[model samples]
Target chain A: MSQPAIETHDLTKRYGKARGITDINLTVNRGEIFGFIGPNGAGKSTTIRTLLGLISKTSGSATVLGYDITNERKEMLAHVGYLPSEVFYYDGMRAKDLLKYAASFYDGDFTQRIQDLAARLDLDLSKRIDDMSLGNKKKVGIIQGLLHSPDLIILDEPTSGLDPLAQRTFFDLIREENERGATVLFSSHILSEVQNICDRVAIIRDGRIIETQSIAELRRTAVKRVSVTAAGEVPLNLATLGLPAGSFAGAETEGPQTSFVFNGDCNVLLSALAARRLADVNITEPSLEEIFMHYYQDGADRGGAAHDSAAQDGAQR
Target chain B: MNVYLFEFRRQWRSFLAGTLTQAIVAAVFLGGMYPMYHDSQKDVEKVLAGFPPRFAAAFGITKDMFSFGGFFAFIYVYLAIVAAIFGALWGLKVFGREKLDRCMDFLISKPASRMGLFWQKALVVLTGIVVMNGVFLGVALWVRTSVGATSPGVGQFVLMALAVGGVQLIFAALGALIAVLAPRLHSVTGLGVGLGILGFVLSALPPMTNESNFKAISPFSYFNVSQMQTQGTYETGYLVTAGALCVVALAVACVAYVRSDVKA
Candidate 1:
């Protein structure tokens, strides 16, 4: 197996009494688009900043492209392209000027690379940076990050202010970059985008990773919604058909129709439904948002210790 | 080398603006002193009827007020003020603008050391000061030759300008240090100007009060242009002290800059 493109061991960042990110252990594989899903103030940016060496980590070890992040910051930074959440640019500078200024730092034919990327992204190089809109500014940032063809591309909320078309174009560019052997670690609160692009995702909540898995695995383990139409009173003991007892959370009855929400394996629920004598039944797969909500809510209720234990188990795997 | 050239290109326009402003102000100040030079000789005779010519000579005015060196000295204080202000402005802007524009990351990401950046910026400011003084000296020489006067050799005039440039450099380095240490202030340029004025006042006060001890505290007093006028030369100790203060200020700035976190 190839070495992990990026790995962090028990990363913790504390700002005085407040916690930044606590014990975040993550591993991202090469050429994979890994999504870091979290809500606002969930330390997603903090983790990305730490990885880029934009901010110091309180205690942890992280390696990118086989270089230690702390000891070999400049060397590691050369191989990593970072897009900060908040973008700032020099005043009165044209986009082309800014790109050239940034390009001067790196070796190789960066000018041609920048020109090609700008053309592909449809960015107007002659426009002044301050005059550009937020979406255009984001495009400028994207071009700068990817122009060098870095080994690891770390983006914090890469599609926050983009229109749907722009977002799709960005994802396509990211896919192309990945195909070129670059690994991507993108953070987002929108689950749909993460679901669409990411090969694996780590769901973070309240400064900790609650779950990390492939989309397919999450879908298979996520709870299913079941709607059953019964001719008469439905039996409460549905587990007799082989579904887990706790799977049948509750049932809603409207005259002859009774619908149940199951919080367990969808396949088992379907088997139980097939064995039942129901007049009508419908099953719907949970959306990524629903799955994320379930895991986040569950983790919040259980608190940090349980989440850490589950994360440890995932890490060990 | 690319980083240095890039910074130079990026800062050229602003530096040009500052240099032009310095030239205009210096022209107005030196031009205004032209009439005062001719009037001072007549006034000296009337104001000191009983004083000996030796006493008048002690003050270093030989009644040839139109001479290039004398006229240059007549406006040297104002010229120094302009040079100091220009240096301070450049210093503050060079260090502080990066923080304000959030471009420190862009610069630091390059293969340039922090101390190297500080020195490069200081060099740029010093170069501009030299160029500005060169223009003033050129103008003074033109005026002297047009009126058919033979003045001091070019080397002597340049040495005197270098002395003033040394003093300007000390204040510029100090301004850069302040900008690096306190980047959040909105009025860093104003602070630099105020500090330059304060240095001038502190340097002037000790001499005006005839206290040699207090003179050591101000870098300006150490570069005593008036004493240089009487002796036709500057003290080696003053030049050493000015050079030492500039080095210390730049050292402090470099240490602080390399260690301080770049606040975006």
Candidate 2:
């Protein structure tokens, strides 16, 4: 396998005595859009900052494009384009000037590239950064990060202030960058975007990654939603039917429809329903949000153990 | 080199504006001192009548207040204030503004080392102070020539301006240190202004006292424009001491800045 574009070994950051990100181990291969999903204050930004060397790590090591994050920060930074979670710019600088200033650090035909990016992102370069709207500022940020065409792109909450149309455009841009062999590590709270764009997702909570899995694998392994209708009352001993353990809420009787809600694998319940008399049956795929909640809710208790196991599973895959 | 140039260009406008404002203020203060010089030199004997020889030796204010040298001394206090303010403003912005704009990440991410950033900003601040003092020196000469007063030679004026620049750098370095240590701009500005006022008060107090040792603690005490005019040179020991303080302050600031966690 080709070498991972970004790697962290037992990466940890501590703010005084409080753990920021503990024992964070992950890798992103070239041309992959890796989503870091987490709630607020979940150390998502902290990990990104550590990787970029914006904040010093308390222990462990990280590398980008095979360059040590600490010792070779400058060389590593040269190959990485980063978009901070909270975007801000010099007060008096025009968007064009800001891009030019950023481009000065790299050697390339960055002017045409920046202009092309600005046109595609719908950002007006003539406007002062301070005077632009938040969404426009974010667009300018995206342009700056992608203009240099670096090998690794680290975006923190890249779609926060973007409209739906612009968000889609950004996703397309990210995909194009990935196709060009850039490795992306993006963090976002929007699960749907993660589901749509990410090849693999790492769920971080309270300074730790709880799970990392491919979309298809997560969907297959996630708890299934099964609904059933019986002519008589709902079965009480549903747990013994080989279905993954979950609550079996009592049946709801409509005018002609009787439905039961069971939080478990729909296949096992369907077989049981097939054996018995059923007026109606329906099975729906759980939404990404539901699957996310399932992991995030219970995974909160499992902590680092779950994270290590999931990372191992992902590595094996 | 490009990053340094870029930062210089990016911040040049603000630097120029600040330096020009300081120059204009210094010019105005020097212009205002014209009337005082004329009044003091109206009669040499009358001006020196009540003054003791010891006071004259201490303050270096002779009957030559009418000349360009005395007039320069008269305006030195105001000029130093202008210099201190300009230095403080530049110092506050050099490192503090990067943190405020969240651009520190971008700057630090570049190939530039933290020590390099410190020196670059210091050089920028020094350049600004030079330009500002150059403008004021030119204005002072022009004002003296127009008023039919004997202007000091260019070398003496340059020496005085260089001394002012050195004094200004001490404050600038102090301001930069404050900005690095303080968490917010308000605190940095407050500390800078507070230190300026404290230095001014201390410099003024030492002259009122009989002891010279007490004045050694204040940077302003090292800048004696009157003595420089009479002796045709500044005290080398004092200048070296002030320069040493500036270097130590900047070194401490760089160390603190590199180690501290960036708030952004």
Candidate 3:
């Protein structure tokens, strides 16, 4: 079998007393659009930096494209393209010049690729880097990262500074790159971006991988946000509705309407609500943030540890 | 190698302008003084002799004040100060500019190793100093030979230039070391100017303190112009110390730079 595109085993990095990342074990298969989802300061960037060897790992080990990240950093980096959260380049260089310099490091002809990306992104190649706006600079970063046609593309909050139109184009470009057999590891706090593209996602919290699942599996686990507008005044107490204990989170009620996130069996919830007077009801998938909160609501008791063994098996399969 | 070429090209224009400015200033300022001193040799010597002993020593004045070599040595003391500061600033920018500008991510994420990048930057620093000193030496030589002024012979002037070059090199390495050791340094140029002025002041301290071992601490004293002129060569012991310091500092800089946790 082919080796995974990227893999880490118990990677940890501690900056004196502060925790950078702790015991992060991850596996991204070849040709997969893997999402690394976490909020700010959640160790997403820390983990990616360690894999790219931008910072040394304090313990454990990792490999990218079959090369040990710590020992064979140069060789590993040859096939990896990284776009950091904040992009900085030589201020005096023109956009084209910077792209050319980036291309010079990899042994290939990237002229056509660069030109295509620049034209599609509407980037002004002649402009000096210092003069470009943040969005334009991000475009330059995207071009430089993809110009080498790397095997693994790692993006850390890659779309933060892009306009909506540009973002659509960038996503299209990523899909095309993936179609061309490039594996992508995208890190972002935004949910829709991950939902739209990622095949699998690993949700991180406070430097630990709390959950890893295929997008379908993750969506299945996410509870529904149910809203009910009763024909008559409903009881203010939601616990008397007869759903599983603690299944209702952040339950709140108005004079005739009620809403709460439901995490238990749908049949039990339907039976509990059937006895109410005729009313309007709406059920939808909970927001990613709400789902994330559920996982974090009860630390370690919410099967985060149980999911670890399942995730390991899932990784192997 | 690509990074090296890119950095060289990016900096060459400014480097050329600054070095030429230094070279022209040195040639015009020092070369212009030679004829004035020579024509009024008697008056210059009488005026110099009447100055207090402390002032004379402060300015590195001795009995050979009327000769071409002595005047050349005297003028070089001031020139070395400017060159050393310029070299220090050059060295500080070698690694500091990347960190200051937040360009570490771009370089560090590339296929190159950290050691490779450090060495490339170190090479650029060394080359910058060499090129700057080369211009200074070239212009000084041209002014002396072309104008046919009352100046030291080619051999003595070359020796003096080499000594000044040594001082510049030592400080340049020191600056590079600081760049690696203090990755978050805010004012590299300010530090360079400060060190240069401090060295200049300390160079005068040894004379006032009766040739104490304290002189060994400053690069400015490594190439004592008075001793170079009278003895016809740089002090072998001090020269060795300067060379050793340059090597050790540069090596430490490379190791520190490679081991540093680059903050993107």
- What tens digits encode model 2's per-residue C-alpha lDDT throughout B1-264? 665575567668866776686667656655665656575665655767778765653444556666766766755655676677668767877767687676776676655566667777777777777777777667767776666665566677667656667778888888888778877665555565677677666666555666788768978768767777778877888878888988888889989887777666
Best by TM-score: 3
lDDT tens per residue, model 3, A29-67: 999999999789989999998898878899988989999
- Greater DockQ among 1 and 3 belongs to 3
Estimate, for each residue in A248-270, the C-alpha lDDT of model 2 and write its tens digit. 43345554444444555556676
lDDT by residue (A226-313, candidate 1, tens digit) is 6777645764345466776445544566765755556766677777667767777777766778777766665665566766786776
lDDT value, candidate 2, whole model: 0.74
Pitting candidate 1 against candidate 2, the one with the higher DockQ is 2
The DockQ-derived docking category for candidate 3 is: medium
- DockQ, cand. 1: 0.31
**Displacement of the residue A28 alpha carbon in candidate 3, Å:** 0.9
| Fraction of native contacts (fnat) of each candidate | 0.28, 0.60, 0.72
Candidate closer to the true structure by lDDT (higher is better), 1 or 3:
3
> In what order do the candidates fall by TM-score, top score first?
3, 2, 1
Judging by lDDT against the true structure, name the best candidate: 3
Q: Which stretches of candidate 3 lie over 4 Å from their true place?
A: A222-232, A241-246, A252-257, A264-287, A297-317, B144-156, B185-187
- Whole-model lDDT, candidate 3? 0.81
Instruction: For each candidate, give its TM-score against the true structure.
Output: 0.81, 0.85, 0.91
Arrange candidates by lDDT, descending. Answer: 3, 2, 1
